[model samples]
Target: MGIITDIVLPVSLAFIMISIGLTLTLGDFRRVAAQPRDFLIGAVSQIIVLPLVAFALVTAWRVEPVLAVGVMIIAAAPGGVTSNLLTLFARGDVALSVSLTAITSLLSVVTVPLIVVTAHQHFVAGSGGEVAGDLTVTGAVLKIFVIVTVPVLAGLAVRHTMPGFALRFEPLARRISAVLFVLVMVGAIYAERANIGSYFAQAGAITLTLNIAMMAIAFYGAAWLGMRRPQRIAIALECGLQNGTLAIAVAASLFHETLYAIPAAIYSLMMFGTALAFVFLVTRGRPAAV
Candidate 1:
């Protein structure tokens, strides 16, 4: 796992982001105009409600200070690519899913840092003890820009300037990204193995509760906002699952603490199962509505 992280994982994540960016055009945002309500609900739910819910859970659970920061980091990071796959599985709006990914990921460079600072100021100030000089907002942004945004922009540029090249390489890029993401998960798990038992033993109920609540908010909140079934599914999955790899990266690179990184590692493993159950429970017998 450590070997993978030091090599394949970083490269793959960059490629994955680039692949997603390659599929984009200005028209993606234009499409949002056609379904403003769905997009608005999804953005609000993801950027606002999801983090708030996470913060509340972290507080209620009395998570270890470092672990609470991890939760907030996950909340701050962009929605995962997994959301799009889950959206497809649940037969939701694919265009909306793609648009949401593109928009949120692009916005993450700014939003994530702000979220991180705010979470720290609010949640960590009283907790006492600064992490280290390495864990600054600028450091977090630089890491994210390198690992996520740059590859995406590079892929997007390639797709735009050399369409034939992009067409040929797109699939390979996505495969690389997937392999990298998996490697990041493995690295995180291995790195945090010693702390896993303690984290779950103390934070397990809180983690599960937070996951369930986030999932519920996606569907129920979207429904309350009068979103259609498809949009609800997309928003729900996005809310429930987070970019755990990014969280771990930020925690490790920016914060310099494994304790702060472990939640994301555990979350990466836990969310897949939790999200699958959610899909089955929410979509069963309904058929693919969208």
Candidate 2:
């Protein structure tokens, strides 16, 4: 577990970020700036609303302090690559999905630390205070930048410099990212096997509730805002499918505590089943592509 946390987790996360980048183009960023409303809604739902809702759930559920922090950390993470894939499967706006994901991934380098620090102060400080010591705002930002931003930028650079190669490699990169994500989740669960059942008992219901509520909010909220069906689907997924791998990596690498990573590991496992159901429900009898 120690070696996996120290070595495998970070490397796996970097690969995932790189895969995200390989799918990106400057146009994805530009598209967000050009048509800001839908993008803003998706980003706000993810970056701001999701964490607030999770915090509310944490308070209402009276979750264990460490597990509460874990939930907050997962909420603070950007939308996962899985969201983009799911959006495509659901015949949603893939372009919007990519734009939301790319923008939020960059923004999370700042937002994650801010949210995590606040959660630490609120939840962990009154406790033993050791977890707070293990995590500092500067260290969190640096880890995010190095593991998330740098790899993404490198992949984007590769795409720009060798367009044909990037095009050919994107599918394989995504496949590798998916495999690495599973391995990371497994490592997180194995590391906490002694308390896995207890952790799940504490976190499973809350995480599932959060995931469902977020998707409902994003989908109906977008509809109320007069967004198209595709945009609604994209927002729903972006809001729901958080980057659990990143959350777990941050928890394990920074806090060195299996307890802190438990919610993310459980959420990651739960999301695949829920997301698949979401895809089927949303895409039933609909066109295959947007």
Candidate 3:
């Protein structure tokens, strides 16, 4: 477990972030400024609305304090590399999806810690439990900056200076990152293998509900607001397929609780099924409905 958290988790997450960075360029960031409306909507959905929805869920459901913090951990995560790939598969705005992932990921340096700390305070600390010792927003921000932001900026630098090498290596990097993701998932569940059933049973319902609700809210909200079909698909899927790897790392590293990482582990396992169904539903049906 120590090896997993200390070595496997951080390295795997760093590689994933680097892989995401491989897909990004300066233009992706510029796209945020160029198309401010969609970006704003996507950002607000993930940053503000997603956490709000999660808080509402945890509070209303009266989830246990540790698991409740786990719920908020996943909620605080940004869109993963999978979101961009799934966006492409869903016939959505690939560029917009990539832009959102890149932008939100960078923003998570600040936002992830903010949400995690708040959740810890409200759910864990407020419950009069011994909270994860000394977890502060500022401390989490620094950890995320090192684990996420620095690797990402390094990836961008590599791509910028050595475009040929980056393009050649990106596919392999992505495959490696995917393998790392699976390893992390297996390790997390295996470490808690004894508790897997009880943990999953307790956390699964809430995580699944959170996934479906957010996707529906984002997709329908975008549609109702008259956003383009592709953009709607992109944002909705982005909201659904969060960076659960990052969430797990945050929980384990900061809170040092496998208990707190349970929701993210369960969530990583299930989000794909829901996302695929959504993609199938829209693609098989009429685009006009969107």
Give the poorly placed runs of model 2, Cα more than 4 Å off: none
Clash count (model 1, backbone only):
2
Model 2 worst lDDT window (10 residues) = 126-135
Clashing residue pairs in candidate 2 (N, C-alpha, C atoms within 3 angstroms):
none
Q: Name model 1 segments beyond 4 Å from true.
A: 1-9, 134-139, 164-172, 288-290
Candidate 3 structure lDDT: 0.90
Q: Sort the candidates on lDDT, descending order.
A: 3, 2, 1
lDDT of each: 0.76, 0.88, 0.90
Estimate, for each residue in 146-219, the C-alpha lDDT of model 3 and write its tens digit.
99999888888889999999999998997898899988988899999999999988899999999999999999
| Model 2, span 128-189: residue lDDT tens | 66654556788889978988899888888888999899999998888888898999899989
**Model 1, 6: alpha-carbon shift in Å?**
4.3
Residue 94 displacement in candidate 3 (angstroms): 0.4
Give the TM-scores of the predictions, in the order they appear: 0.90, 0.96, 0.97
Q: TM-score for model 1? A: 0.90
In candidate 1, what are the lDDT values of residues 48-145, reduced to their tens digit?
A: 88788888888887877767877888877777777887888888876788788778887788778778766776666657867456455676677777
Backbone clash numbers for all candidates listed: 2, 0, 0
Model 1 lowest lDDT segment of ten = 1-10
Distance from true location, Cα of 171 in model 3, Å: 2.2
